[model samples]
Target: ELKVEQNPLFLSMQEGKNYTIYCNYSTTSDRLYWYRQDPGKSLESLFVLLSNGAVKQEGRLMASLDTKARLSTLHITAAVHDLSATYFCAVDKSYGQNFVFGPGTRLSVLP
Candidate 1:
């Protein structure tokens, strides 16, 4: 059975602060995906790490994966109010069909 876990399930940050959210999985995966969600909304894809050491960045958000350790990280740089949202990391191992998602990290960026 595959399980995805995320740390710091809740976070509160001030503007210009930085933090990292971690995702760990029980099974091996060649691809991992990061997504974001606002309250009562659907998820928006943020990053797709396809290989070891793969990294993606956009604005204040960055994500990377280390497949060998079954770990992935989402780093927040200089977080702002606009970056406040719930983030999730998903592991896909069933030929792009099944995906196990981590418990989302709810981030609240204060002014």
Candidate 2:
């Protein structure tokens, strides 16, 4: 079965901090996506990169995919209070028929 898992369900980082969240999958994938969600808000779509060597970024967050490794990375450059939210990376393994979402990474920005 194709599944997704993320480490550190909760993260507390000081202002101007950097971190990385890892996403691992159990099987092959055709596309990978990154999403961010703020408190009480719906998912804010981040990236929908296709193919193996695809990478995308915005603000303090950068995401990359490795089909060969079946892994994805979300690197946070410098976290701020505004960046305090939950992040998730999902994989489209079934070509839109099914989506496997990671456990999610909740970030707390300390001022």
Candidate 3:
């Protein structure tokens, strides 16, 4: 077990579509984060789900975390071409900046 797991490394979502991606982890973690990245660009903060049942959303993206189950989710609503990018969920193991990232979800939102 590599501590964290994410499924369907790639997604091709049509415009106006909706989808959900999952993240599962082992052991206890301090924080979970969802980040978006454009091609060859730095990460853009999406959501930071802190505790159990913590949910946060912005624009067409929503994220939720369940600490007890060590799980997290990122949901996309009404996808658009501008949403094409990579999404990553990282788990903070240490109190500091130590983080483990999922393989990443590569999304291609086509019109």
Best by TM-score: 1
Error of 1 at 74 (Å): 0.3
Q: Give the C-alpha lDDT of model 3.
A: 0.88
> How does model 2 score by TM-score?
0.93
**Model 2 lDDT per residue over 31-80, tens place:** 88888999899998898878898888887888899999998888888788
lDDT by residue for model 3 (1-111), tens = 338888679999899999999998897874899888999899998898777889998999889999888999998899889989999999988857688999898999988
* lDDT tens readout by residue for model 1, 4-82: 9999999999999999999999988979999999999999999988899999999988999999999999999999999
TM-score of each: 0.97, 0.93, 0.92
Residue pairs in steric clash, candidate 1? Answer: none
Structure candidate 2, residue pairs in collision: none
> What shift in Å separates residue 61 of candidate 2 from its native position after superposition?
1.1
By TM-score: ranked, best first: 1, 2, 3
Off by over 4 Å in 2: none
The positional error of residue 91 in candidate 1, measured at the CA in angstroms, is: 0.4
RMSD of each: 0.8, 1.2, 1.4
Question: Model 3: residues >4 Å from true position, as ranges?
Answer: none
Q: Which ten residues in a row are the worst by lDDT in model 2? A: 91-100
Clash number for candidate 2:
0
